[model samples]
Target: MSHAIGAPLIWWVSDYTLANESALIVGDDFGSIAKVKLESETGLKDIEIIQQNNQQLSVRLPATISYHSHALRLYQPDLKTFERVWLNAPKIDWLQGDMGVKTSTGQGWLQLSGKNVDTLNLQDAFLINKTGKSYSLSLKESDPWHAVFNLPKQIPVGSYQLKFGQKVTQPTIPPLEVFIVNQPTDFQQRVLNIKDFHQSEDSIDHTIAFKTALADLATHGGGTLYLPAGHYRLSNSLFIPKNTQILGDGNLATHLIWSKIDKQESIALINLEDNTRLQGFSMYHDDAAFGINSPSDRVINNVHIEDIVIRMSAYRGHPTSEMLTKIYDQILKRFSNKLDTIRLQANNITLKNNDIYGTGRSFAFIDSHGINIQNNKFYNGRRGWYSFSGCSEIIFRNNTITGADLMASGGGINTLGNKVSSRNLYFANNTLGMFNGWDREAFTSDGGGASYFGHVQSHKENQLLLATNLRSKGLRLTPYEGAVLFVVDGKGVGQYAKVISMSENLVHLDRKLDVALDNSSKIIICPLQENYIIVNNTISDAAIGIQLYGTGLNHVVYGNTSIRTGGINLLGLWYGGYQSAWYTLVAHNALYGSANTRKFNPTRTDLHTSNITVEARPRSTDELNLVYGIVIRNNQLYQNNGVSIIGSQNARKNMDAIFVDPLDN
Candidate 1:
C-alpha cells in the first residue's frame, strides 16, 4: 500500500473472516469505498472497509471481485514478533506489480510514504525489537521534554522497532537501532602523563582539538568525547555543543591548566551551556571573567560549574576611582530585565570549596540568578563574589572570606552595580573576616554618578534575605571600616530597597582616623527615590546607625537600638529638587549613651512626617527641623543623647511635618 505524507487518518478496518461460501467484514465507514476479498481464484474483488471515522460497518461477501468488490485485511499484533504500526494508515493510491505476494498469513501491506504526523496523533511512542527488546519514544530534546538523563548501565545490543505514541493517534517511526559499546575502565582509558606527551602545549591547539572533536562526533554520528585522567595544558577558549556530554576522567588526577599566560579576555574554561554539567577534574584560571556564564534562555537549562577552583590571574590595574567606576558600569548593564531563573536552571552553581582570588575584578558572579558561593575562600583580590544581574532571591551564604580588606581598591560582596530591580535575594550565615585591602568591611557600594546627578540614576534592585553570619571580631577595615550593612555611593537614586531582616549576625567596623570619611556607608542612598526599612537589630561600634541623603523619599527607620556610646551623628532630613522625601517617620526606640554619644549638641529632635506609622518608647539626642510630611508620633522616651533633632547652620525649613503621641498608649 502507498500513502502521501500529511494525509488525515479517517478510517480503519474492524474485522474480516470467511464462513464457507461467504466472507464477512466490519468497521467504521468514512466516505471512501470499502473492499473485501476471498482467496479462491483470481485476485481481491469486493473489499469492505470502514472509511468514515468514529463509525462502524459490517458486511457479507463472496469469493471474487465479481462476486464481492474490495477487501479489508485482518490485522493483529503478533505477540512474539516485532511489528511497526503506521499512523494515519496511508491510502493505496494505485497498487502496481504485486510486491507483497505471499498471501497465506494475511500479512497486508501498509503504506507509509506521507502522512500529517500531527493529525496522526502520534505521541507517547515506544520501540520493540525482534528479540523482545523495547525503547520508549519521546519528543525533540528540550527543557520541557528533557532527555532521559539516567542511562542504564547495561543493555543488550541489537535492532528495535520504534512504536508510535501509545495513543489513538500513534504512528510507528522507522525503528532506530543502537549499539551499546562496552566503555573501557577508568584506568585503561586514562590518557598517559600529559607532561610526557607535551609538545609545546598551547591554548589554541587544545581549543582546535575540542572544536574538531565536537564536529567529528556530529558529522560521523555522535558519541561520548572523553578526556581521561591526566593534566592537559590549554591556552585557548573551548566551545561545547548542546545534546552532547564532554566527559572527563572523574579523578582529581585529571586536570586542565591554561597555558596561555596572556590574553585580554580568555573565554570560559568549561562552557556547560543550556542545562549541562561538568563534574570531575580541577580547572585553574586566574584573572578571567566567568568559569561559566549560564545560558540566557530559560529553555536552556542546568548549567553547573562545580568542583573547580577559578583563580583570577593576579594582574595589576590602576585601582583608581575611575577604574572601579568603569568596571561597575559593565557589571550593571549585563544583569538587567531577566525573569525567574529557577535555581535548578541556574542553581547548585557551587563556587564551593574552591579558591577564587587576586583577579582584576570579581571572582565569580551570577548576573542572572540562582548561585551559591559557600565554603569558598578569597585572597588578595578585589571582591570575592559580585553580581547585579537580577538575583531575585539568591545570595552568598555560609562562606569564609579571609582577605576581605579592600586593596585601597574595592570591597567584599559588592552588588551596588545593579540599577534594575532584583527581587528576593538572600544573604545568610556568611563570614567576612580579618583581611588586608582598601575597604575592609563586607558591604555593597552603589555605582555612583554615571551621567547626571545621583537623583536621576536607576536604583539598586535587591530584595535581600539577610541571615545571621557573624562578620564581627575577626573582620578588620584598615583604610576605613565600621558598620556592615552599608553602601558608600548612592547610584540607584530612585531605587527603593526591599528590606534588611536582621537577627544574629555580628558586624564590626574599625574607626580609622577621620571616621567621617570612612563613615560614608552609614548613609543609605535613596538616589532618585528609594525607601529603606530597618528593624529590631543591634547597630553598634560605629559612628552612626543609618544615614540617608539624596532625592529619595518616605524612608522609615525604626526598631533599631543604636549602642553608639561614642556619639550618634545624623543628616537630620533634607529635601532637594523633585526628590523631596515625604512622610519620613522615626519612632519607638532606646538611645542610651554618654553625652558625647550625642554628636550634634543642641540638635533638632522635635520632628513631623505625613501619613505613616511610628510607635514605641524612645531615647537619644538631637532636635527637629520643621519639615512637612515628617510625622513623629508614639510611646516611651528615655535619657536622651545628641540633639532631640538638630536644625544646623545653613539648614533650610520644611512644611507641615508634625509630631504626636497616641494618648491611649
Candidate 2:
C-alpha cells in the first residue's frame, strides 16, 4: 500500500500494551522509518524494531513503562507522524498484602497487591514529596493484583505518597504514604520536636520557633510536630498547614496558652488546614474569642482532631439583646459568629474525644459537609452547640452538652437552616441539658430549629410559581436546585417535590404535582432544612426537647427520652409571615409533657421565636402556617396533652398527624 505525501500512515495495531507485552504495529509506508518512539511527560524511549513484514513493524514494549495517553512518534528524514493512545487499562481501587516501600536491603522498593494491578502500566506513577517533587519508578514483578517497583536511590529521605494516574483535584480516595529513612531505627525518631527550634529556654514567645519548625518540616516533606510536657505561650494564631500534625505529650501535660495583646479583635488561636491534625494537647485562651477554626475560603479535606481540650478562661456572660441582634444579622446572611470557640467551615472532618468549654457558642459549623462529631463534651456559658446554615451529612452523636443557656433563639445541637439549606443531618445517642437548677421550663424553642421564607403564587403540573422573587441578593442566575417545595395547606397538602431548577418567580420540580392545587392552596419553598434524623437522645429540663420549626421535610425524631423536658415539639413556624413542614415521624419516645404539634407565632413575646430574626422579623400574615404528614406513635406522654394540636391556624384545617398503636402509653 502506497501513501500520499502527508506522513507515515498508521492503520492499526495488534496490541497497544501499557506493560511489557509483544505487539505488532501494521501500517503503510514503513520502509523509510528510521526511529519509532514512545513519549510521555517523564521522557522518551526508542521502541525496539524486532523485524518487518511488508508494511508491518514487530516490536516489544519497554520493561518498565510509565506513560499516560502518550504519543507513538514515527520519525524519518523530514517526515514524521504521531499516533496517541490512552494507556490506563486497569482500575486501582485499593491495595493489600505487603505494600511496603522499604525492602530488606538499604534500597527502597514497592511490593504491593491490590485490585486490578496486573492490567496497569504504572502510568504517571511517582512518589511525591510534600514540596511536590516527584521521583520516577522502575517496575520488577507483574502478577494478578500484585506489583513490585524499585525506587530511585537518589530520592531524599522524607515522608512521601505513592501516587498513580491523574492528579486529583477533589477529595477522593487518598494515595498511600510512607516514611523513607536510612534505617529502621530512625522511624522512632521521625517526629520533629518543637523544642529543637527554640534557641533559649528563657524565650517566652514560641511563635517564631513554631513557624520555623513547621517551615523546616514542610521543606523535607511533612511530619508530626511534637510538643513535650511543658507550657508554651503563643502571641499569634498558629496555622497548621496541609499534610501536617501538631501533637503534644498528653492533654493534661502539654499546654498552649494564647496571650493575645489585641483585645478588640477576635481570631482563632489555632487555624487548621486540609489533611491536618491537632491532638493530645490542652489549649487555653483568655483575651481573644475564638479557640480553633477552619476558614471557608480554604477548601479542606479529611481533618482529624482528637484528645484535645479547648478552654475559654475569660467567659463572656449571657448573650444580651444586642448580641442576639448581631447573631441574627449573621444568620440572615448565612454566616456564623466570630466569637464561636470552634467554628469550622470545611468538609470531611472528624472531631472526637475532646472537651470544649466556651463562653459563647461552643461549636459553630457553617457551609460544611460530612462532619462527624462524637464522643465529645461541651460546656457553654452563653449560647450552645450550633450547626448553622448550609451544612449536610453531619453526624452529632455520643456527645453531651452541659450549662447550655437554651436561649430563645437556639441552644444544644441547633441546626439553623437558610437559603443554602441543611440536609442529611443526624443527632443520636446524645445528652443535652442545662447545668443550673431547672428553674426555666424546657421548651422546643430552646432546641433544634429550621426556618426560611415562603409565599405561593400559582401551581402548574411540575412547577410552582412563586410570589417572592429570588433574583435579589445576586440570586437571579443562581438556581435553587436542591431546595424543596411543599404544598402544605389546602388542596395539594402532604405532597412535596424537590426543586430541579428555578427562575425569577418559577420553580421546576422533579415530578408532576399529584394533587391538584388552586389559588387558595398555600405552598412553601424551603431552602432551609431537610432529611434529618434526631434519635436515641436524652434531654432534661428543656422546654422542648426537639423542634423542627418553619420549613423542613422527611425528618425522623425517634427513640428519645425527655426528663422534665417539654417533649418533642414540631412547629410550623412563621418566618417572615410564612412556614411549612411535612413527612416528620416522632415515635416511641418518653416525655414528661405531651408531644405537641402547633402553629406558632414568632412575633409573640411568649413564643420566643425572636432568636433568628433581626430586621426581617416574622409578621402575622393571612397565609397558612402548615404542618402535615406528621406521625406520632407509641409515645409515653406523662401529661394530658398527649399528641395535642395547638393554635387554630390553617395547620388544623387539613393537618395530617397519624396516631398509631395506642396514641399515648
* Candidate achieving the largest lDDT: 2
lDDT of 2 by residue, 460-492 (tens): 788777666766533433445776666655654
Report lDDT per candidate. Answer: 0.33, 0.58
Once superposed on the true structure, which residue ranges of model 2 sit more than 4 Å away at CA? 1-190, 261-266, 315-338, 404-418, 435-461, 464-479, 515-521, 593-625, 639-641, 649-654, 657-664
Off by over 4 Å in 1: 1-209, 214-227, 243-252, 261-267, 270-272, 285-301, 315-353, 364-367, 380-385, 404-418, 449-665
* Per-structure clash totals for the candidates: 105, 7
Q: After superposition, how far is residue 101 of candidate 1 from its true place, in Å?
A: 62
**Deviation of model 1 at 556, angstroms:** 13
* Candidate 1 TM-score versus the reference: 0.37
